[model samples]
Target chain A: MAKTPDSPLRVIGTSVTLSSEVQSRIRADLGFAIEFDVLDGSACLRRGVTRPDSFDIYDQWFHSVDVLHTAGSIMPIEVDRIDRWHQMAPMYRGAGLASGAPGRRQCVGRDPADVLFVQADNGLGREPTHQVSMLPTVCNADGFAYRRELAANRSGPESWGWLLEQNWGARCMLSQDPASSVTEVAMAARSAGLVEIADCTNLTIEEIDALFVLLNRRRKAGHFTRTWPTHEESVRLMAQPSTGLGSLWSPAYFELCASGVDLVYATPIEGYRGWHSGLCLSAALESAMCDRAYAYLNWWLSGAPGAILARQGYYMSVTEPLRDVLTPAEWAYWYEGKPATTPLPGPDGRISVNIGDRRAGGSYQDRMSAISFWSTIMEESNYLQRKWLEFVG
Target chain B: MVPSSERRSSSSRKTSDPIAERGGGYLYAMIHDLLQDKIASGALPVGATLKEGTIAAHVGTSRAPVRRALRNLAKSGLIRAADGQGYIVGKGAAVPLSSRQLYDTLNGGIGAVDRTVSAERIVQIVHGAIVAVMPFGHYRILESELGEHFGVSRTVAREVLWRLMEQSYIHKDRKSHWIVPQLSARDIRETLQMRRALEPQALRLVAHGLPSAFLTDLASRIDAVLADFQAVTAPRIDAIEHDICHNLFEDLQNKRMLASIRRNQIPLVVPRIFRRNFPLRDDLAALRLYDRILSALVSGDVDAAARLLEIHLDRAEALMLARLRVLSVLPPPRTDTWLSAIH
Candidate 1:
């Protein structure tokens, strides 16, 4: 499967190496024979991380694409390939584009249109998996988990409010990821008249001080145990018989349940917190490898063995059938309704616990947003996380 | 948003270490690797206690070298802090060597169910988990780790961290990376001033928009207080006062207004305030003022409600300041060394 001796395909990825999950998927499924080098983190930061005119593909996240694209680090996918490419959902098609940059477009609704002009003068095929500054990837969403026994222990919205009203204080295990999930939880709690967020933006010194006073009161009364916990502790306590509820991302929640806990994920009455990201080819690569990169992408999304392997690496895939892949227990607990807790809320504001999207009776855009939001969240989560640490640590 | 370049002085200068000079780029990898090891091997242990001095000593390095390491640890879910204590190893410390697919499987499963765990219970669980991990007589774990062990969500976590900071339980750099905060009378005084500003304001609002249901609830609560005062076998007078005051003021219905007031006042005062012996004098005055306010509200005298509100707030401020004055005289750590960036 090596490239013809006369022509070679080269790829330079930021943060991903030849040994990475995505690369292995490409190697295994697409069977592309090419030289792939992963630029170190510092290399990307130092600028000109790759040799000029050395490679054909430059893979990066959608959020980070701005600088690279502007610097002509990579070229867009060829135009002819866009129509032939697998279609993406419409929800995340144009997310995180620096508010108003021209040339960014949506293709197949699932992927962000990678602006060809950002890096090179070539049109590029857009994969709808996620909006990429460089390459394609799935997204993530924030979800809730609850103790079966606790929900059974109480009933109705009043009890639900009472549950959060319990004395543990900020000891609740929620991610500081800063995606909508955190705000959703706080907002929902506030809406239910249970908890309060000091201020969303521009919290003054006085507000911060007031939070401290309330925190001290709660601390003295043991309202919040300690503000923050490690993701691991958050996971463990969620599974254990400790607290009654937790808030986290779908992937993280999945990890906990796979560890053999009886916990279940719940969608609050509120909407899921969301974000998206993507993959792109580098401009510095040799011009000859563009087609092969497309072929590799197609093969990866075709649900072939390599793609399956890559999906297993924790990154969501656009290839596989989500329903068939999930176990019956998993399906019922996650996608289907888990009988033990609040049923997953439908995209409709109704209280249906059914996991599939009930929005106008289709699930495509919902699924795309689910993936795009995940990636965007992770990339943007750093600041929210820091802020959260400052708020409660 | 201060320009990133402009924001890079003073705190950034003094707070940054040689390791940080390597930048968030280099540090992330090293920290990630270190955390990967800690989470994988359970060397960090779920719910185990953490200490700056101990971590510094065990790693054979100074506090600066270990600061980035601890921040990285905290980021990865390997560690947290106990309130007024130190960091504790978190359950996430034991990250499994699963493929991302396995993680997906697990994460999907965890995400699917409706587990209703509260923040307090989560904290207790982590605290208990650490306690379980500790051997007999390791009080240092409780003292060192409780304040640092908070969940990862930025908003809520920041709240807890700020509290730890206000109480001199934890500290952070300009980028807001965290460390266990040291406590002193000075810190306590500043915290009191913060309490003075916010607490009374919260009380005032709770008075203004005194919901009908909350008022009924307060009536019963006051009756309970009167009952407690009358009961010959009453356990603690302060308990009744605490309950009456807490239930009357902590109503969720009034949270927005109260939170609004408190949010504006706490940070401005907390860094300068210090904690002292529970100020019985202030507490008594607060109790009497609350009683009068409750009476006025129950009597439907909006004017009395307004008057008592001002009195309550004024007394709280005066009492808190009196305490702060005494603490200011203590031979505390260099007060200027503690920046307002504790949040």
Candidate 2:
């Protein structure tokens, strides 16, 4: 099916990982028609896997690789085709890179590295291979952001339980994302001594029922009425004084802090919920469009775009490419866990990091190592989503 | 109040029951397809004026469903409306068949039994649709919508819901909402345990009285499927499963045991619905397992065949879960007018 050259290369992803700024930049640099569509987390994953003919590229969580690969929704991404495969993070390579270093400890949840490689059987596995289901693009460690007024100078490591605390009642927001939000709530329930779960990622139906019972009780008491579905909505809510806290991403947190809210992105002693985003070609994308989609994937690793993400507190898959792109001061503040000597402007040209401000949780290595969960589609994902609806009610 | 016998007979005469086919579509669908088949076969000749009452009596249904079938056919331009009453069979041909000849032809040709599509059929159709989507997520079934969709009364729709409720396929929550619950991993495993315990015994009962020719026929079908599974269609796969789950139990007089075993066959619905919407990617696991079971049965090794069937159930339970995981990522391709996803 040959297409007219002017037909845009449509890319679909959640709004958190995509921005109009990125769209404008890519269009200007590549000089082609590009369609950027933002969908809810589940909607994006659904269309990505089931309706590959709808878009050229899918940008979403690596956690989806299992279902995506199993459905054959995505084509195998050739590592040889990647411009900076060798420069990419070892953590994302395979099982061999998962040892004897600062990243020595194995991940607790569904590690992106574990399912990174496309095995000879055309399934995802930890075994190293040349082909991949997706190209790891951006990543971050997530937790809720809170107001200084809500904390009141309380000084120990923040607790995930703070989300369920009565003090933040009604003012507190919940994530609209079923998988990510439920994991956060499970951690909070576990941390607060409200419940004991064997694995936060994989909860039994009884456990899920118990957690939702508590959540429903709290919701009836008006504890978590507000929820945000997108990063923009998250920032909008967190920037308000009435909204004391909720689950959040780093970009939204930075946006809130930069807008001068005395916001604190929590580093719960429990651990951060780590998540990674990647680019995948739709099974339907072919020939010339395939070449263009690959070009778009390569552009993600072109250092400039990765640096843009770094400004918002995200780590690229290949950090080395970003070293020269980001200033020394900027790199030290964001990735190396140092206080900023000067105000750091985000990709938007706004001073997102104020003078003397330090990154939360610490550096890339510190936060990532402390991760206890990764955003993934659990085996009980369908059940979780079903009950998640009952709670969100 | 009406007498109980009168009420029951009144419902039986409602024909093309919405209660029996809210989302199921057994009676009317059969009528539509049968009439279309007749038209295509030249059994309903050119310019045959299908009067509502005549077609209804001949098909053992009410004029309402016949009128509906004719209206639908007219919409498709397969037939056209006559000025006096009812539809003329040909789109353009206008010489009407005499009423006597039309009645004689329909009476002699169509074999729709009076009770072939009554309450029991409703159980099958509604149950099948319900089971197919149970693995996807929780869905709400509304009585009013069900009634509206099936062109049945609310009380009839409620009766069908009650039958499904008795089976635990659906339930009325505290708010009186009809809910088809999601099949969790625990549910799948628990259901599988029921299948393993009952199916082996069923295989034993059926295999003991099974004809050599019957077993051979089933084996040949399996062999053909194994030879080139890609050539097999979704409906063909469903038929193959029915051969084991229903047809194989033809000799088994234990209706309760057969019902129990078939209830545990909800696992089949996942792959059935999935393969129908997606391409048939030949897992061949079912074919291979059935081949082994058939060989045992063919050798008069009834106990061995039962053992193999138990193993087949084990494999089925796992594959069902895997298919559910894959299906979870997509919105169900089939949703009823009466059914809505809870989320």
Candidate 3:
């Protein structure tokens, strides 16, 4: 892979401090001479390229990966050694293929889900695999990042709860992407007796409307702040005191914390949501490169270098064997990452799971179930999105 | 304490100062500081009636300096008055709700309340409310009844009269203000139907994405409504319920969607009477739906939360229909006819 910096084959990712550091670490640990091009992962994802010949790997939200896979541009992998890879979360195992001939390679890497890239301000990591196409990657822990000064001035997490309360809805800041649909889903789920939508396979209008009405209350209360068009805008909004409450990933946000912006990153005592990102080799990549990509994937999933990085400041989807990377202080900060688990909507107002359930290693079927649920939501997302636009406009 | 000669010299010194000499920057600064203090102290309340002659006398200055200060206050929304009323203390004597209030009146079923509000009462209240604060010469209201109120020529009254109607604040027929029209249950339902279609998604996005403080504020506001609802007597509940919901809808418009639901929809629904007695059942039902919605939001169940909103609107429309039947407000609901066309 002797390509130039702008080589069509170079995979680009939007990333910040920890991720950039991870990139350098991967280059050194693997001792690969190949140049790794790292850009803003979000921008590249939005570009939405499907041809594997042009870019060999993509590290972004897994939702986009599924979209690309559906487009038939990325090749899928079915290496026999896949079983050897460490599967921390079942999401790492990849989803079953529903279309195209069997054995057509799809998804190259082991766990793009665990990538450290996140929007800057809130530091909430990119979409967790659970919320997107299932891939074995890093599972992002959700938390709040506050401007150090503003956070210090406030008593504690309780001050931020004001946004979630009756009169304070407009003061909170969050990502507005239709893809990461967490904050909206969480509010709706809370209203629907804590029924999570991402986990459920089917959803009805009543459940959707209940969520909408709850949101409407917040709007009526004068609590909403701004609807950022992109993640970067949200990050910038979070970074300043003039703006408030950055909802973002743990590792990614830690870098912002280290830089001296006072932010409090916490999972709601009632549990917030996370977006899962992972690698899915498309059905179109060259077999040899796909094999190499799979090797890298397996290596990442095996959890040595990734574990070391996680110790530094990140959460991986697949359970890893790392010890002592995160100190007690860092662990306290990290423990709240997945503090609240949410339930997904099933059918007829029924729910599939409770948000409070502890997440553990997923059974093999978990990956498929999650994907099936996500696909269903995406299928109806256009309609929901249209309604959202019409309603809010 | 100074001698007359010294005083003359000091006065001359003032005239010779650079700010006074050219840009009058110092003079402006002094006046600004004085005005700022008066405003901050609430001594010079916004819209407090002011006369040019009195201000000039009080400031011990010519009308020019005072005029500049008035202009600045006017720009800041701190001072306003009716034409010939001079400067008042506040901005536009409390906008109450602008034309959006007409929406609430319609929504509250004003026409159907106990006795018919006579055209004379309507004209007096509407004209007094409008003209009491209307800037002088803003429009000429030529309607004869209104012209009689202002003792103005019919030509001037007609202009102002038509302007109000055009803004949808009021409606007029050949003889009287159109207090009642082709208002039907179907029209009100159709209008509400549009709100149901548009508001829920916008609200979900806002609740999902709004900053923390806004959310908390919302929760408290909802709680306040709950408190108010408990406090009101059953007979007076409808008005209170309408007020709380109206404020909430306005806030929603301001925060998200940015669409004026009240301005566009309330007018059509407000004038029609509730067909059902104790409209509070519908009102309470609507309020409870929102309460559940807020809970879901705190819990983070976006889909279920959104679904509830749709259900709430549907139920509310049903309640409206039932109330309309009680009041004999429209023909019976047709099962097969499309609702949108009726509006």
Candidate 4:
């Protein structure tokens, strides 16, 4: 039970968090060797709940908090222990941005209890408390990426409706996951005048049916050439000549750019799909393991990891800390959406952005403001999955 | 109306009945009891016309007492006033009375004609039907219809409604109609969370005090299921789930904890609903996990058993949530006849 410098800290997360830079930094800064169990989305959820003792830390999206809390698989972290707890963006602190516009309604709600904050009595509350179910980490607005040549031929503003355009034929790709893909396609269906879903996050049975029917029709018509299950595959697909456009993650967009692919990560007039990722502690952690878990969580807030993730186009929950960690030029290029003054390294420590290149959306706030919906496991997700599989087949 | 020839034939058939000598208040009470029995047994079909003179002639009673009896039946929602005339049996008039409902209505001690029904009994019948149909979506609970169906006064029906409101099961809508809110995913998760917290703790409290032989037997049953989980039938899985999650802790003698745990039993009812559309996949992992928990309990390691119980609950919650998501897309289940819609 005694603490040791070489004690292994088991971290369970998606492949995005297990990047070489992120893993190496945790080992270097936290002074403990890290063991990672990188998994896909469903596997991560299954392991997080059923095998709490198998890992010390979980880095995943906020949507999984309900499942983890319901399972009692995660213990609340003391906000006092997080080094930059107060330094987080005002949105996390119950304050809206300067524009007075709200964050994505799917994730953040008007009530403090609606978010991840946990009170001492083990109920979700909005006001700051000693305990939090999870610590918010890297987040960003995501949208589709398309080949420059394909966009040059199109007129007018870019739209999510374009994904369903017969013009794209079988050249377009889509994400294979149900949670995000369903929301993305629903937005596209609505924008394309195919269906009008009331709430993208909690789709009803009828809306799910209509959306899937539309998707299936397009699938049978050979509208989609392929589907990408991972960000790496998504990047590869978007970089190909055959793929005119597809649902793309920020990291994959950066990866595509690093490979010198001429692509435009669109700020679709309709809106960007938003998502946030965070860290949670396993409830099984006790004594020294709890201490090491806290150390790993605090290290995530210490600016270095945020900076690394920022290079991949993610906004750290606490951007102030990242301001010092990143160069002024890199900050202007990434957060301000200004042209890069000089070449900048991607998350993988390779030059992905050259001088005079600008982000697609004007600024981080502007992009976050236009979020149409966030990735979520909707109440209708099982229906979405079954239909999604049929479309895939 | 009863045909004239049939009425004359039925009058001769009634001579053996004991009610022929009953008079005054007893005569009307006897008629009411006889009619109640007829309705309960579906002798009177829904929407069947019941003319005052026809029933009076058939039963060898004056129209006065038969009139009073029909009025009582109307008040109870078993019969409604026909257009401009006599009464007709209501839609749910033929719904077989539950034994408990009957016991509550009947004077069990003396078998006397006391027809007073408690609010609690009415609440139980209505609550059972509401919980059954609520997973489908919003439903209107007609106060008048409910009163008639349960053979209670409006005041008595209001008492049942107020009790259901206290439990957060049903509420009055804008039009003053009682509505059962749609069962949302959040509601399911919240209930499951409470179950995960309370049920495992309940298990821990009873594990040490439980008979070792009983624990061993339960463990062996679970082990047999786990050994061949892929071939296990749905009912077998349900039996094991009920034993561990519910039946085992029934003897804890802690009513508050047990009651709270019982209130969270909605998830337990979901498997049967989903099995209607989808084949129940054999979840070997859950079976194995439950087996471990039972084995730990059998060995008297309460802490390990409680821990494993938590894990099993987590898995169950996930499975139930997934099942509900699929079930949500399907149309609502057929409404039982006992459930009447106001709007």
Candidate 5:
């Protein structure tokens, strides 16, 4: 598409994070024209890196900071321009890990903070700086979800091992994203004693080879129903009565719940997979449109957007604004580990939670503290991609 | 130095230069020297037939030069035209040499370890061919086919393999076959890191000795690419990288360090591989970095030039690694005649 000097700030991101409702609100409140292009995961990353001139602001997971920053596709976001800059210091440094987690200050691979801060030398680093790679937005702990009625055993502590069992047969589903799917598969395989993996976040060549070799055998035996890339596809595939379990994100899980599907989010004792999404300023953005971009970045930390994300089970960076927009019942049920006082709405404004029901993982802090690994690109990510594609083939 | 007929001897006396004596070019002189040595040594026996193509293939040249050499030999009474399309080694009328005799003459007792098929030229060509398709997958270099393709002995092909191995471009498998290893992200990262650390050190070493005229020429190349980004070609980008990453260090004096720097220039090859299927975009960002480094070098700011080279290497490693991951889905190109996919 041709863009002019006075064109609206063009934002590109996955449907997982970007929404039409946010576009409408940003257009009305920011007093500027806006356009959003929602693509699947791979297409969004490809477009963002290969053609930075195509968009103004990019919204996606922070794992892409290394890719986007290295390509010079994104510009630095000045922390000073953020309204609650000092107030959000704890979260900026936290990188979605709660202070009480098992390894309180240790992160094995990448997190939002690992590549978030901009150094004096104009490079990305972990230490806090006046500039950052992205403005941290919606983050949450994700886990596998399965049909409660279809599962063989329902009365015990759930294990990640169940997804790989032969009983699930062809009813099992998984994501096509290698970063998340590889880690999730390794966790399941290790839990089942099928293979031993030293670390899930960063995989070695031998471990990846071994995992895929075994996965190929399992896959050939009809262990997987299918693989999906977008949340919408996940919802459509998992809605089938015959589908047993699948790797799922919050949005799809909540959508299925609202549409009245019987499924359970298994917060395995092993832990939850943590992910953080954020907003970025494009390197090609015209200087005149920068102030409006800052307003939009600060707007994410304000009240309304965080509440909308909360309906999809995501927590914002600063919790104060979210408290104002959500009901006391919604807040307690979603953040305080309490039973729902009444039915809660999904992002689509449908009643997704019933009265007297409790979330599988408890409050926001409880889920955040249980994150086993953040979805990240490994040092051998390219090799892993090659092997993963061969396995899929 | 073998004695020819009096006519040949007189011709040699008339001119000290061998090419002038032969009335042909350098290739003709080379072919002449080779055939005369083989014929005088009785390697090509009295009845052996020497075809133009046979002499050409033996010395790794074209028929034109070999024809000149053979014709000159015939005029000197060394070999004469036979009834067939070849020449007879003996001057007098005689039966043409058997094909078996010619084969034996040309074979020249070549052993299993033949080592010199224009080693310098072959290594350069093979290295480039390997790098172009390396990102795809592991490839087995066929020694026999390599020899046949170059019209050299297997020993010469093996020598090329050894040279490639010394440069870390290929490896010997358990079967002792020469194989080019698959290119991986880690390979790209390590190469980039090595270049980042070494190139700046190299620039500092050779900076003072670099010629202003040479540096000016390189700057012009960068400006040419910048002048029209859309019109840039792969070979042009390659020449620019070669001038900076490679040719600039000819006077560095540190052999091991220079070799290491050359090894790390594989990032320059990644774009060439991709350019085969996609057009290269030499946009302002990369070219400006090149311009800045050259400007520093031209101004005698060695420290500034070195610093800029390090930054360039860092950015290069990241970009190359990403391109490699994108190409991971496609297997290595299967088009090379002498390369077979190991998988």
Candidate 6:
């Protein structure tokens, strides 16, 4: 039996799930059309768990692995089926076992059972379980961004505290996502000397109170210009003449640069907030659809998507395959964080990085290693969401 | 806060079990030691008031231990009664003492010795032990074993048993043995049902009375937690829950409602026990939902907060029940020597 256009494999994720370049490459390289359904984070999770029939594959972050698995909404993929399984970075393979730092653990890699291949009878063990919850894909570290023009006159080093400075009053913006925003704010609060938090990742009620008091006072004083709910809004906010500094995702930063905005994504002295995005199979997929999904997953790992994502400022799980797809200049500029030898195109094929342009943080390894924390669903996330809503209001 | 070195020393000397160290007897000693150290070091100014309720909330414990700690502080001459209010930091003895002398006195003097366990302390100790073991199954508690374990008289042990009976944690059998009730699916469902009915109403009643500054601060704290939800621990979740569901509602001053809410917290014992024995399980969805409810409350949308609270409770109920089922299948936890389950 042959698959037809009427029965395209359904894939659900956020708008930026697959860039146009990657999607086109999938069609050209894998010879299959994917029906993409882009939904917001909450909506995506709801649809993925409640109506598994609605999508065959999910492209999202690893933080939701536990929630999805617990809901019985996703099936484990056999590691043997993922042709590039052994090629994954050791940092991801060993997960958090390699990193012993207090707050630098990537959520996905921190728990082997959550992401690694597990056997049907055996749980999420360290050794190969022959099955995995999700196939690792593109990942990147996130940091704040600022208009170079606004920060040109600042005296001190680039710090997260700059977001809370009185000078940037009504000029700074924060993401509206509770997990990301709260973590950013905490980093800012700690850097600014407004509060002393034991663990910026897991703030206590008292520490939270101290941080928010400053935030509320600043908010009432018109310190914040906007709270963006989406990455597009974040880019828009950063582009606004009045907005000087704000939280930014890597893709957005690339988009802004491509649009000729003179902004510098700050590799703050504090550290970057890292995150990893991956692919998950829906449990409801039929045997035929499952094969197509595996093919799609394999195609992503075949180097084209990784190379495309690298152009947009993301590092793929397996860098070996990506090396073949990218030129030496591209690799040096993106991964090494060195000055670009030649102008590089953004994912949209627009000139984003001019020759001699350098990444703020030196090297992907340096930035990833310096991660003070990762975007996570904290234990107190319910309270966090409520607080975030209040902060937004 | 007590210095980590002193806390370690005192904790090691007191009990090996972490749960016991968190309970009333150890809490009282820890608070007393910490306050004495603060007073001796002059970190607590000469006139600073030490209110039991404030101290209890700060240390994440009940007023029982704080009250006892305060009494001990007063007895040691580190603090004196401040009119009709509460204990105030002071040099109560006729002899003028230097900071070093006071420090020496606190470290090696009258308050350093082990005090006889009172009936109240016995009650707290037994309650903590019961909660630590309740998930395993029904256990018969012998008055003689309880007395011998705590080095208390049988009369004192009987008082503790009576207190447990009053709290509905244990009941006397026909043979006069106190039996802890086996936790059932129905009990969990009922407890959650009570929580659903009462907690939302409590949030609604207290939402208006809460200070905007405090609520804003609370919202910010919640935001911080949500920002890194994956790294969150069970204790952190317990603290946040205390702030939203217990601490905020306690301000309503509804004695009966507050008491009923406290009593219905029976299901919390399961999670507390399970977490002590197992690695922290991910509860991100509940935390995310809680974040939304806090957002509503902070925005002054009392109705929305109440509605969200209901949904949050429902989700929590389901998650907790599921966890309870998992816990039930695991082997019975190792019993601490201090916690004797007589046949």
Task: Name the candidate that leads on lDDT.
Answer: 2
Per-residue CA lDDT of candidate 4, range B1-343, in tens? 7432233221222322112322322445666877788678765657666777766555544566568778989999999887666777786433444334433433332233222334554566666567756666567777766655544446666888898887778888788878886566566778889988898889878877776655665677678876776666765666666666666776778988887887777555566555434444435567788888877877778999889888877766666776565454444556545454331
- The positional error of residue A142 in candidate 5, measured at the CA in angstroms, is 0.7
Query: Which residue pairs does candidate 2 place in steric collision?
Result: none
Colliding pairs, model 5 = B113-B155, B114-B155, B114-B156, B115-B155, B115-B156, B116-B156, B136-B332
Q: Stretches of candidate 5 above 4 Å error?
A: A1-5, A93-107, A152-156, B1-126, B132-166, B172-179, B185-343
Q: Which predicted model would earn the best DockQ?
A: 2
TM-score of 6: 0.54
Report the number of the highest-TM-score candidate.
2
Model 2: CAPRI class: acceptable
- Quote the positional error of residue A51 for candidate 4 in Å: 1.6
| The TM-score obtained for chain B of candidate 6 when compared with the true chain B | 0.63
TM-score pick, better of 1 and 5? 5
Compared with the true structure, all predictions reach lDDT values of 0.40, 0.76, 0.43, 0.71, 0.74, 0.70
Full ranking by lDDT = 2, 5, 4, 6, 3, 1
Off by over 4 Å in 2: A4-7, A96-107, A153-155, B1-117, B136-168, B171-179, B193-212, B219-231, B244-260, B282-319, B332-343
Q: Please state the error at residue A12 of candidate 2 in Å.
A: 1.1
Write one digit per residue (lDDT tens) for candidate 4, span A258-357.
Answer: 8888888888887777777789998877667777887888888888988888898888777777788999999999999899999999976789999999
Q: Residues B21-118, candidate 1: write the lDDT tens digits.
A: 22232222333355446556765456655555554343333344345566667776667755545566664343333234323322322322211222
lDDT (10s digit) by residue, model 1, range A197-216: 44222223333344345434
List-wise, what DockQ does each model earn?
0.02, 0.33, 0.01, 0.06, 0.17, 0.01
> What CA root-mean-square deviation does each model show from the true structure?
27.8, 8.6, 26.5, 19.3, 11.1, 24.5
Better of 1 and 4 by lDDT: 4
How close is candidate 4 at the interface, in terms of C-alpha RMSD after superposing the true interface residues? Answer: 9.9
Q: How big is the positional error of residue A289 in model 2, measured in Å on the Cα after superposition? A: 2.5
| Model 3 stretches with alpha carbons more than 4 Å out | A1-9, A16-18, A31-53, A62-69, A82-135, A143-170, A182-222, A227-234, A302-313, A318-321, A324-379, A387-393, B1-343
Cα lDDT for residue A331, candidate 4: 94
